[model samples]
Target: MDSFDSGGVRIAYIDVPAVGGSGDPVLLIHGFASNHAVNWVNTLWVRTLSQAGYRTVALDNRGHGESEKLYDPEAYGSEDMAGDAVGLLDHLGIGRADVMGYSMGGRIAAHIALDHPTRVRSALIGGLGMHLVEGRGLPAGIAEALEAPAGTPAPNPTAAAFRTFAEQTRSDLRALAACMRGSRQTLSRAEIAQIVVPVLVSVGTLDTVAGDGPGLAALMPNARALDLAGRDHSTAVGAKQHRDGVLAFLAARP
Candidate 1:
Protein backbone atom coordinates (compact mmCIF):
# COMPACT_ATOMS: atom_id res chain seq x y z
CA MET A 1 0.00 0.00 0.00
CA ASP A 2 1.42 3.43 -0.98
CA SER A 3 0.42 6.89 -2.21
CA PHE A 4 1.37 8.98 -5.23
CA ASP A 5 1.00 12.64 -6.14
CA SER A 6 -1.59 13.16 -8.89
CA GLY A 7 -1.90 16.77 -9.91
CA GLY A 8 -0.82 17.73 -6.39
CA VAL A 9 -3.33 15.32 -4.83
CA ARG A 10 -2.04 12.41 -2.77
CA ILE A 11 -3.74 9.37 -4.30
CA ALA A 12 -3.46 6.14 -2.30
CA TYR A 13 -3.13 2.82 -4.10
CA ILE A 14 -2.16 -0.83 -3.87
CA ASP A 15 -0.11 -2.46 -6.61
CA VAL A 16 0.23 -6.25 -6.52
CA PRO A 17 2.37 -7.75 -9.21
CA ALA A 18 1.74 -11.14 -10.73
CA VAL A 19 2.46 -14.13 -8.54
CA GLY A 20 2.15 -17.92 -8.95
CA GLY A 21 1.62 -17.20 -12.67
CA SER A 22 2.08 -14.34 -15.08
CA GLY A 23 -0.46 -12.70 -17.38
CA ASP A 24 -1.60 -9.27 -18.48
CA PRO A 25 -1.84 -6.60 -15.76
CA VAL A 26 -5.27 -5.24 -14.86
CA LEU A 27 -6.04 -1.92 -13.19
CA LEU A 28 -9.10 -1.84 -10.90
CA ILE A 29 -10.84 1.48 -10.29
CA HIS A 30 -13.44 1.48 -7.52
CA GLY A 31 -16.93 2.98 -7.37
CA PHE A 32 -18.04 6.21 -5.72
CA ALA A 33 -17.84 6.22 -1.90
CA SER A 34 -15.75 3.06 -2.18
CA ASN A 35 -12.08 2.28 -1.64
CA HIS A 36 -9.95 -0.36 -3.33
CA ALA A 37 -10.48 -2.87 -0.54
CA VAL A 38 -14.26 -2.63 -0.39
CA ASN A 39 -14.76 -2.51 -4.12
CA TRP A 40 -12.14 -4.94 -5.37
CA VAL A 41 -10.13 -6.69 -2.64
CA ASN A 42 -12.92 -7.35 -0.20
CA THR A 43 -14.98 -8.82 -3.02
CA LEU A 44 -12.12 -11.21 -3.96
CA TRP A 45 -11.25 -9.54 -7.27
CA VAL A 46 -7.60 -9.17 -6.28
CA ARG A 47 -7.41 -12.80 -5.20
CA THR A 48 -9.28 -14.06 -8.26
CA LEU A 49 -7.24 -12.02 -10.72
CA SER A 50 -3.95 -12.90 -9.05
CA GLN A 51 -4.73 -16.62 -8.98
CA ALA A 52 -5.86 -16.33 -12.59
CA GLY A 53 -2.32 -15.05 -13.40
CA TYR A 54 -2.90 -11.32 -13.84
CA ARG A 55 -1.08 -8.49 -12.09
CA THR A 56 -3.52 -6.22 -10.26
CA VAL A 57 -3.47 -2.52 -9.36
CA ALA A 58 -6.15 -0.62 -7.48
CA LEU A 59 -6.43 3.00 -6.30
CA ASP A 60 -8.55 5.07 -3.95
CA ASN A 61 -9.91 8.03 -5.86
CA ARG A 62 -9.11 11.59 -4.71
CA GLY A 63 -11.80 12.02 -2.06
CA HIS A 64 -12.07 8.47 -0.79
CA GLY A 65 -10.01 6.04 1.29
CA GLU A 66 -6.59 7.35 2.41
CA SER A 67 -6.32 9.70 -0.58
CA GLU A 68 -6.17 13.48 -0.24
CA LYS A 69 -9.57 15.04 0.46
CA LEU A 70 -10.63 17.74 -1.98
CA TYR A 71 -13.82 19.55 -1.04
CA ASP A 72 -13.85 21.47 -4.30
CA PRO A 73 -16.43 20.25 -6.78
CA GLU A 74 -14.15 21.09 -9.70
CA ALA A 75 -11.48 18.78 -8.30
CA TYR A 76 -13.62 15.66 -8.77
CA GLY A 77 -14.76 15.19 -12.36
CA SER A 78 -14.74 11.83 -14.18
CA GLU A 79 -11.83 12.91 -16.41
CA ASP A 80 -9.80 14.26 -13.48
CA MET A 81 -10.22 11.02 -11.63
CA ALA A 82 -9.32 9.23 -14.87
CA GLY A 83 -6.08 11.23 -14.84
CA ASP A 84 -5.41 9.88 -11.37
CA ALA A 85 -5.63 6.37 -12.81
CA VAL A 86 -3.09 7.28 -15.50
CA GLY A 87 -0.93 8.87 -12.83
CA LEU A 88 -0.85 5.60 -10.92
CA LEU A 89 0.24 3.80 -14.07
CA ASP A 90 2.91 6.44 -14.68
CA HIS A 91 4.12 5.94 -11.13
CA LEU A 92 4.35 2.21 -11.75
CA GLY A 93 5.94 2.64 -15.22
CA ILE A 94 3.11 0.70 -16.81
CA GLY A 95 2.49 1.63 -20.45
CA ARG A 96 -0.86 -0.03 -20.99
CA ALA A 97 -3.06 -2.46 -19.08
CA ASP A 98 -6.54 -3.95 -19.01
CA VAL A 99 -8.95 -2.00 -16.80
CA MET A 100 -12.16 -2.68 -14.89
CA GLY A 101 -14.27 -0.09 -13.13
CA TYR A 102 -17.48 -0.47 -11.10
CA SER A 103 -20.31 2.07 -10.75
CA MET A 104 -18.76 5.52 -10.61
CA GLY A 105 -15.49 3.84 -11.43
CA GLY A 106 -17.17 2.69 -14.65
CA ARG A 107 -17.63 6.31 -15.73
CA ILE A 108 -13.99 7.09 -15.00
CA ALA A 109 -12.97 4.03 -16.99
CA ALA A 110 -15.09 5.22 -19.91
CA HIS A 111 -13.41 8.60 -19.71
CA ILE A 112 -9.99 6.95 -19.85
CA ALA A 113 -11.04 4.79 -22.76
CA LEU A 114 -12.16 7.88 -24.66
CA ASP A 115 -9.39 10.31 -23.72
CA HIS A 116 -6.39 7.99 -23.35
CA PRO A 117 -7.33 4.88 -25.30
CA THR A 118 -3.68 3.99 -25.81
CA ARG A 119 -3.20 3.59 -22.06
CA VAL A 120 -5.85 0.88 -21.83
CA ARG A 121 -5.72 -2.49 -23.52
CA SER A 122 -9.36 -3.25 -22.67
CA ALA A 123 -12.03 -2.17 -20.20
CA LEU A 124 -14.81 -3.84 -18.21
CA ILE A 125 -17.52 -1.52 -16.92
CA GLY A 126 -19.98 -2.90 -14.33
CA GLY A 127 -22.69 -1.54 -12.08
CA LEU A 128 -23.42 0.95 -14.86
CA GLY A 129 -25.06 0.99 -18.27
CA MET A 130 -27.54 3.25 -20.08
CA HIS A 131 -27.44 5.78 -17.26
CA LEU A 132 -24.12 6.82 -18.75
CA VAL A 133 -26.15 7.88 -21.74
CA GLU A 134 -29.36 9.10 -20.07
CA GLY A 135 -28.85 11.02 -16.82
CA ARG A 136 -26.91 11.36 -13.58
CA GLY A 137 -26.83 8.18 -11.50
CA LEU A 138 -27.43 9.56 -8.05
CA PRO A 139 -30.11 11.99 -6.96
CA ALA A 140 -29.50 15.71 -6.46
CA GLY A 141 -30.21 15.56 -2.72
CA ILE A 142 -27.33 13.16 -1.96
CA ALA A 143 -24.85 16.02 -1.68
CA GLU A 144 -27.13 17.89 0.67
CA ALA A 145 -27.62 14.77 2.73
CA LEU A 146 -23.88 14.30 3.10
CA GLU A 147 -23.63 17.86 4.34
CA ALA A 148 -26.46 17.38 6.80
CA PRO A 149 -25.85 16.80 10.49
CA ALA A 150 -25.09 13.20 11.36
CA GLY A 151 -28.48 12.55 13.00
CA THR A 152 -30.58 14.79 10.82
CA PRO A 153 -33.44 13.11 9.00
CA ALA A 154 -33.55 13.50 5.24
CA PRO A 155 -36.70 13.85 3.23
CA ASN A 156 -35.10 11.70 0.57
CA PRO A 157 -34.48 8.21 1.93
CA THR A 158 -32.01 7.39 -0.82
CA ALA A 159 -29.95 10.40 0.08
CA ALA A 160 -30.03 9.51 3.75
CA ALA A 161 -28.94 5.96 2.97
CA PHE A 162 -25.95 7.21 1.01
CA ARG A 163 -25.01 9.62 3.80
CA THR A 164 -25.17 6.79 6.29
CA PHE A 165 -23.12 4.57 4.01
CA ALA A 166 -20.49 7.28 3.63
CA GLU A 167 -20.31 7.77 7.38
CA GLN A 168 -20.03 4.02 7.85
CA THR A 169 -17.06 4.02 5.50
CA ARG A 170 -15.45 6.88 7.49
CA SER A 171 -15.40 9.18 4.46
CA ASP A 172 -14.97 12.93 4.59
CA LEU A 173 -18.55 14.17 4.32
CA ARG A 174 -17.67 17.47 2.69
CA ALA A 175 -15.31 15.90 0.24
CA LEU A 176 -17.85 13.25 -0.69
CA ALA A 177 -20.44 15.96 -1.16
CA ALA A 178 -18.09 17.71 -3.55
CA CYS A 179 -17.37 14.43 -5.32
CA MET A 180 -21.07 13.81 -5.84
CA ARG A 181 -21.35 17.10 -7.66
CA GLY A 182 -18.09 16.94 -9.53
CA SER A 183 -18.28 13.37 -10.82
CA ARG A 184 -21.72 13.76 -12.39
CA GLN A 185 -20.10 14.09 -15.80
CA THR A 186 -21.78 11.56 -18.12
CA LEU A 187 -20.98 10.46 -21.65
CA SER A 188 -23.35 11.51 -24.39
CA ARG A 189 -24.51 8.98 -27.01
CA ALA A 190 -21.98 10.46 -29.43
CA GLU A 191 -19.23 10.16 -26.86
CA ILE A 192 -20.15 6.56 -26.11
CA ALA A 193 -20.09 5.77 -29.82
CA GLN A 194 -16.52 7.07 -30.06
CA ILE A 195 -14.86 4.64 -27.62
CA VAL A 196 -12.60 2.32 -29.61
CA VAL A 197 -11.28 -0.07 -26.97
CA PRO A 198 -12.88 -3.47 -26.53
CA VAL A 199 -15.24 -3.28 -23.55
CA LEU A 200 -17.69 -5.42 -21.62
CA VAL A 201 -20.53 -3.80 -19.71
CA SER A 202 -22.13 -5.92 -17.00
CA VAL A 203 -25.13 -4.98 -14.93
CA GLY A 204 -27.60 -6.57 -12.57
CA THR A 205 -30.91 -7.30 -14.23
CA LEU A 206 -32.65 -5.49 -11.37
CA ASP A 207 -30.31 -2.55 -11.04
CA THR A 208 -32.19 0.72 -11.20
CA VAL A 209 -29.16 2.95 -10.97
CA ALA A 210 -27.76 1.46 -14.18
CA GLY A 211 -30.26 1.28 -16.96
CA ASP A 212 -30.29 -0.95 -20.08
CA GLY A 213 -26.84 -2.54 -20.14
CA PRO A 214 -27.63 -4.15 -23.48
CA GLY A 215 -28.70 -0.87 -25.01
CA LEU A 216 -25.56 0.90 -23.86
CA ALA A 217 -23.36 -1.89 -25.12
CA ALA A 218 -25.05 -1.79 -28.50
CA LEU A 219 -24.12 1.87 -28.77
CA MET A 220 -20.38 1.32 -28.29
CA PRO A 221 -18.21 0.42 -31.25
CA ASN A 222 -16.46 -2.49 -29.56
CA ALA A 223 -18.48 -3.58 -26.54
CA ARG A 224 -20.69 -6.34 -25.24
CA ALA A 225 -23.19 -6.44 -22.40
CA LEU A 226 -23.94 -9.12 -19.83
CA ASP A 227 -26.75 -9.40 -17.32
CA LEU A 228 -26.32 -10.93 -13.88
CA ALA A 229 -29.48 -12.70 -12.84
CA GLY A 230 -31.21 -11.66 -9.62
CA ARG A 231 -28.67 -9.00 -8.67
CA ASP A 232 -28.71 -5.29 -7.97
CA HIS A 233 -26.02 -2.62 -7.95
CA SER A 234 -24.68 -3.34 -4.45
CA THR A 235 -25.11 -7.07 -4.73
CA ALA A 236 -23.85 -7.34 -8.31
CA VAL A 237 -20.31 -6.45 -7.24
CA GLY A 238 -19.86 -9.76 -5.42
CA ALA A 239 -21.62 -11.90 -8.00
CA LYS A 240 -19.81 -14.99 -9.25
CA GLN A 241 -21.19 -14.62 -12.76
CA HIS A 242 -19.78 -11.11 -13.05
CA ARG A 243 -16.27 -12.36 -12.23
CA ASP A 244 -16.58 -15.13 -14.77
CA GLY A 245 -17.78 -12.69 -17.39
CA VAL A 246 -14.81 -10.40 -16.77
CA LEU A 247 -12.27 -13.19 -16.92
CA ALA A 248 -13.91 -14.59 -20.02
CA PHE A 249 -13.87 -11.16 -21.67
CA LEU A 250 -10.18 -10.68 -20.94
CA ALA A 251 -9.45 -14.15 -22.25
CA ALA A 252 -11.58 -13.56 -25.32
CA ARG A 253 -9.32 -10.63 -26.20
CA PRO A 254 -5.44 -10.57 -26.56
Candidate 2:
Protein backbone atom coordinates (compact mmCIF):
# COMPACT_ATOMS: atom_id res chain seq x y z
CA MET A 1 0.00 0.00 0.00
CA ASP A 2 1.16 3.53 -0.79
CA SER A 3 -0.24 7.03 -0.30
CA PHE A 4 0.25 10.66 -1.37
CA ASP A 5 -1.02 14.08 -0.39
CA SER A 6 -3.50 15.77 -2.70
CA GLY A 7 -4.11 19.30 -1.50
CA GLY A 8 -4.18 19.01 2.31
CA VAL A 9 -5.62 15.51 2.47
CA ARG A 10 -3.66 12.27 2.28
CA ILE A 11 -5.01 9.54 -0.04
CA ALA A 12 -4.15 5.82 0.03
CA TYR A 13 -3.47 3.80 -3.13
CA ILE A 14 -1.80 0.79 -4.71
CA ASP A 15 -0.08 0.29 -8.07
CA VAL A 16 0.77 -3.26 -9.12
CA PRO A 17 2.59 -4.38 -12.23
CA ALA A 18 0.99 -6.90 -14.49
CA VAL A 19 3.74 -9.47 -14.74
CA GLY A 20 2.73 -10.58 -18.23
CA GLY A 21 -0.02 -8.16 -19.13
CA SER A 22 0.21 -6.93 -22.70
CA GLY A 23 -2.88 -4.77 -22.61
CA ASP A 24 -3.08 -1.08 -21.81
CA PRO A 25 -2.69 -0.10 -18.17
CA VAL A 26 -5.98 0.04 -16.17
CA LEU A 27 -6.78 2.35 -13.28
CA LEU A 28 -9.34 0.84 -10.90
CA ILE A 29 -11.58 3.02 -8.75
CA HIS A 30 -13.72 1.50 -6.03
CA GLY A 31 -17.22 2.44 -4.81
CA PHE A 32 -18.47 4.62 -1.93
CA ALA A 33 -17.56 3.64 1.62
CA SER A 34 -15.43 0.89 0.10
CA ASN A 35 -11.67 0.96 -0.26
CA HIS A 36 -9.38 -0.59 -2.85
CA ALA A 37 -9.12 -3.79 -0.87
CA VAL A 38 -12.80 -4.56 -0.23
CA ASN A 39 -13.88 -3.33 -3.64
CA TRP A 40 -11.09 -4.56 -5.92
CA VAL A 41 -8.32 -6.77 -4.61
CA ASN A 42 -10.50 -8.99 -2.43
CA THR A 43 -12.94 -9.30 -5.31
CA LEU A 44 -10.17 -10.64 -7.57
CA TRP A 45 -10.22 -7.56 -9.81
CA VAL A 46 -6.53 -6.76 -9.34
CA ARG A 47 -5.47 -10.32 -10.15
CA THR A 48 -7.99 -10.60 -12.96
CA LEU A 49 -6.95 -7.41 -14.70
CA SER A 50 -3.28 -8.12 -14.14
CA GLN A 51 -3.53 -11.67 -15.39
CA ALA A 52 -5.24 -10.32 -18.49
CA GLY A 53 -2.32 -7.94 -19.10
CA TYR A 54 -3.28 -4.69 -17.37
CA ARG A 55 -1.07 -2.86 -14.95
CA THR A 56 -3.62 -2.22 -12.18
CA VAL A 57 -3.75 0.97 -10.14
CA ALA A 58 -6.35 1.62 -7.46
CA LEU A 59 -6.97 4.10 -4.64
CA ASP A 60 -9.06 4.74 -1.56
CA ASN A 61 -11.19 7.72 -2.61
CA ARG A 62 -10.06 10.14 0.15
CA GLY A 63 -12.40 9.38 3.06
CA HIS A 64 -12.20 5.64 2.91
CA GLY A 65 -9.50 3.10 3.81
CA GLU A 66 -6.37 4.45 5.45
CA SER A 67 -6.61 7.85 3.77
CA GLU A 68 -7.14 11.12 5.61
CA LYS A 69 -10.63 11.57 7.00
CA LEU A 70 -12.71 14.71 6.76
CA TYR A 71 -16.12 14.63 8.42
CA ASP A 72 -17.33 17.96 7.14
CA PRO A 73 -19.59 17.83 4.08
CA GLU A 74 -17.77 20.73 2.43
CA ALA A 75 -14.51 18.83 2.44
CA TYR A 76 -15.46 16.15 -0.10
CA GLY A 77 -16.88 16.82 -3.54
CA SER A 78 -17.29 14.37 -6.42
CA GLU A 79 -15.21 16.60 -8.68
CA ASP A 80 -12.57 16.88 -6.01
CA MET A 81 -12.63 13.10 -5.64
CA ALA A 82 -12.30 12.74 -9.40
CA GLY A 83 -9.45 15.20 -9.24
CA ASP A 84 -7.85 12.92 -6.69
CA ALA A 85 -7.79 10.14 -9.25
CA VAL A 86 -6.28 12.41 -11.88
CA GLY A 87 -3.88 13.72 -9.29
CA LEU A 88 -2.73 10.18 -8.59
CA LEU A 89 -2.03 9.66 -12.28
CA ASP A 90 -0.13 12.92 -12.38
CA HIS A 91 1.84 11.97 -9.28
CA LEU A 92 2.83 8.70 -10.95
CA GLY A 93 3.70 10.55 -14.18
CA ILE A 94 1.08 8.66 -16.15
CA GLY A 95 -0.04 10.64 -19.18
CA ARG A 96 -3.23 8.65 -19.60
CA ALA A 97 -4.70 5.20 -19.05
CA ASP A 98 -7.91 3.21 -19.13
CA VAL A 99 -10.10 3.98 -16.10
CA MET A 100 -12.78 1.80 -14.53
CA GLY A 101 -15.03 2.54 -11.57
CA TYR A 102 -18.13 1.22 -9.82
CA SER A 103 -21.16 2.96 -8.24
CA MET A 104 -20.08 6.33 -6.81
CA GLY A 105 -16.72 5.64 -8.34
CA GLY A 106 -18.60 5.26 -11.61
CA ARG A 107 -19.88 8.82 -11.28
CA ILE A 108 -16.32 9.99 -10.61
CA ALA A 109 -15.19 7.99 -13.63
CA ALA A 110 -17.78 9.79 -15.77
CA HIS A 111 -16.45 13.11 -14.55
CA ILE A 112 -12.92 12.00 -15.38
CA ALA A 113 -13.98 10.86 -18.81
CA LEU A 114 -16.02 13.95 -19.54
CA ASP A 115 -13.86 16.56 -17.85
CA HIS A 116 -10.47 14.92 -18.25
CA PRO A 117 -10.84 12.98 -21.48
CA THR A 118 -7.22 13.43 -22.49
CA ARG A 119 -6.22 11.71 -19.27
CA VAL A 120 -8.36 8.66 -19.85
CA ARG A 121 -7.97 6.15 -22.68
CA SER A 122 -11.41 4.60 -22.13
CA ALA A 123 -13.79 3.94 -19.25
CA LEU A 124 -15.40 0.81 -17.86
CA ILE A 125 -18.33 2.13 -15.83
CA GLY A 126 -20.26 -0.37 -13.75
CA GLY A 127 -23.09 -0.17 -11.21
CA LEU A 128 -24.25 3.16 -12.60
CA GLY A 129 -26.46 4.26 -15.46
CA MET A 130 -29.31 6.62 -16.51
CA HIS A 131 -29.94 7.60 -12.91
CA LEU A 132 -27.10 10.00 -13.60
CA VAL A 133 -29.88 12.03 -15.19
CA GLU A 134 -32.88 11.15 -13.09
CA GLY A 135 -31.05 12.14 -9.89
CA ARG A 136 -27.57 12.29 -8.38
CA GLY A 137 -27.91 13.19 -4.70
CA LEU A 138 -27.97 10.72 -1.89
CA PRO A 139 -31.48 9.95 -0.71
CA ALA A 140 -32.49 12.32 2.11
CA GLY A 141 -31.28 11.24 5.54
CA ILE A 142 -28.69 8.83 4.15
CA ALA A 143 -25.94 11.15 5.24
CA GLU A 144 -27.69 11.82 8.47
CA ALA A 145 -27.49 8.16 9.32
CA LEU A 146 -23.73 8.22 8.87
CA GLU A 147 -23.35 11.29 11.02
CA ALA A 148 -25.77 10.18 13.70
CA PRO A 149 -24.28 9.48 17.07
CA ALA A 150 -23.56 5.81 17.66
CA GLY A 151 -26.61 3.87 18.92
CA THR A 152 -29.05 6.32 17.37
CA PRO A 153 -31.38 4.59 14.94
CA ALA A 154 -31.40 5.68 11.28
CA PRO A 155 -34.50 7.60 10.23
CA ASN A 156 -35.10 5.90 6.89
CA PRO A 157 -34.39 2.81 4.85
CA THR A 158 -31.93 4.72 2.66
CA ALA A 159 -30.06 5.77 5.77
CA ALA A 160 -30.17 2.33 7.26
CA ALA A 161 -28.89 0.77 4.07
CA PHE A 162 -25.79 2.96 3.92
CA ARG A 163 -25.28 2.86 7.66
CA THR A 164 -25.19 -0.93 7.51
CA PHE A 165 -22.77 -0.98 4.60
CA ALA A 166 -20.49 1.41 6.45
CA GLU A 167 -20.55 -0.82 9.48
CA GLN A 168 -19.86 -3.87 7.36
CA THR A 169 -16.84 -2.22 5.84
CA ARG A 170 -15.75 -0.63 9.10
CA SER A 171 -15.67 2.74 7.40
CA ASP A 172 -15.53 6.06 9.19
CA LEU A 173 -19.26 6.78 9.32
CA ARG A 174 -18.78 10.51 9.72
CA ALA A 175 -16.48 10.76 6.72
CA LEU A 176 -18.95 8.77 4.63
CA ALA A 177 -21.73 11.14 5.57
CA ALA A 178 -19.60 14.04 4.43
CA CYS A 179 -18.82 12.21 1.22
CA MET A 180 -22.49 11.68 0.48
CA ARG A 181 -23.33 15.30 1.02
CA GLY A 182 -20.55 16.56 -1.24
CA SER A 183 -20.13 13.94 -3.97
CA ARG A 184 -23.33 14.46 -5.88
CA GLN A 185 -22.09 16.13 -9.03
CA THR A 186 -23.70 14.85 -12.21
CA LEU A 187 -23.13 15.15 -15.96
CA SER A 188 -25.87 16.62 -18.09
CA ARG A 189 -26.79 14.89 -21.33
CA ALA A 190 -24.82 17.54 -23.20
CA GLU A 191 -21.77 16.83 -21.09
CA ILE A 192 -22.03 13.07 -21.56
CA ALA A 193 -22.61 13.51 -25.28
CA GLN A 194 -19.24 15.17 -25.58
CA ILE A 195 -17.23 12.31 -24.06
CA VAL A 196 -15.27 10.68 -26.90
CA VAL A 197 -13.72 7.74 -25.16
CA PRO A 198 -15.31 4.34 -25.76
CA VAL A 199 -17.27 3.37 -22.65
CA LEU A 200 -18.73 0.13 -21.36
CA VAL A 201 -21.68 0.75 -19.05
CA SER A 202 -22.35 -2.47 -17.19
CA VAL A 203 -24.94 -2.98 -14.48
CA GLY A 204 -27.02 -5.67 -12.91
CA THR A 205 -30.38 -6.04 -14.59
CA LEU A 206 -31.92 -5.66 -11.16
CA ASP A 207 -29.86 -2.68 -10.03
CA THR A 208 -32.36 0.03 -9.14
CA VAL A 209 -29.53 2.22 -7.92
CA ALA A 210 -28.13 2.54 -11.46
CA GLY A 211 -31.37 2.95 -13.43
CA ASP A 212 -31.31 1.92 -17.13
CA GLY A 213 -27.89 0.81 -18.27
CA PRO A 214 -28.85 0.56 -21.93
CA GLY A 215 -30.51 3.95 -21.77
CA LEU A 216 -27.34 5.54 -20.45
CA ALA A 217 -25.34 3.86 -23.22
CA ALA A 218 -27.69 5.23 -25.83
CA LEU A 219 -26.82 8.73 -24.64
CA MET A 220 -23.13 8.37 -25.35
CA PRO A 221 -21.48 8.70 -28.77
CA ASN A 222 -19.33 5.63 -28.23
CA ALA A 223 -20.74 3.38 -25.55
CA ARG A 224 -22.35 0.00 -24.94
CA ALA A 225 -24.09 -1.84 -22.12
CA LEU A 226 -23.56 -5.23 -20.57
CA ASP A 227 -26.41 -6.72 -18.51
CA LEU A 228 -25.59 -8.86 -15.53
CA ALA A 229 -28.88 -10.75 -15.87
CA GLY A 230 -30.09 -11.29 -12.30
CA ARG A 231 -27.44 -9.33 -10.50
CA ASP A 232 -28.21 -6.32 -8.33
CA HIS A 233 -25.82 -3.49 -7.54
CA SER A 234 -24.07 -5.34 -4.73
CA THR A 235 -23.97 -8.79 -6.33
CA ALA A 236 -23.06 -7.51 -9.78
CA VAL A 237 -19.54 -6.60 -8.76
CA GLY A 238 -18.58 -10.25 -8.41
CA ALA A 239 -20.51 -11.56 -11.37
CA LYS A 240 -18.44 -13.48 -13.90
CA GLN A 241 -20.47 -12.02 -16.75
CA HIS A 242 -19.33 -8.55 -15.78
CA ARG A 243 -15.71 -9.67 -15.89
CA ASP A 244 -16.17 -11.31 -19.27
CA GLY A 245 -17.81 -8.21 -20.69
CA VAL A 246 -14.97 -6.01 -19.48
CA LEU A 247 -12.32 -8.29 -20.95
CA ALA A 248 -14.15 -8.60 -24.25
CA PHE A 249 -14.77 -4.87 -24.48
CA LEU A 250 -11.21 -3.94 -23.57
CA ALA A 251 -9.85 -6.57 -25.93
CA ALA A 252 -11.97 -5.28 -28.81
CA ARG A 253 -11.20 -1.57 -28.34
CA PRO A 254 -8.48 -0.09 -30.53
| TM-score (C-alpha, index-matched) for candidate 1 | 0.97
What is the lDDT for 36 in model 2? 94
Off by over 4 Å in 2: 21-23, 136-138
> Could you say which candidate leads in TM-score?
1
lDDT of 2 at 159: 76
Each candidate structure's TM-score, on Cα atoms with residue i matched to residue i, is 0.97, 0.96
Residue-level lDDT tens digits of model 2 in 70-176: 98777777788988999999988889899999998999999999889999999999999987767743568888888788778988776788888899899998888
lDDT of 2 at 61: 92
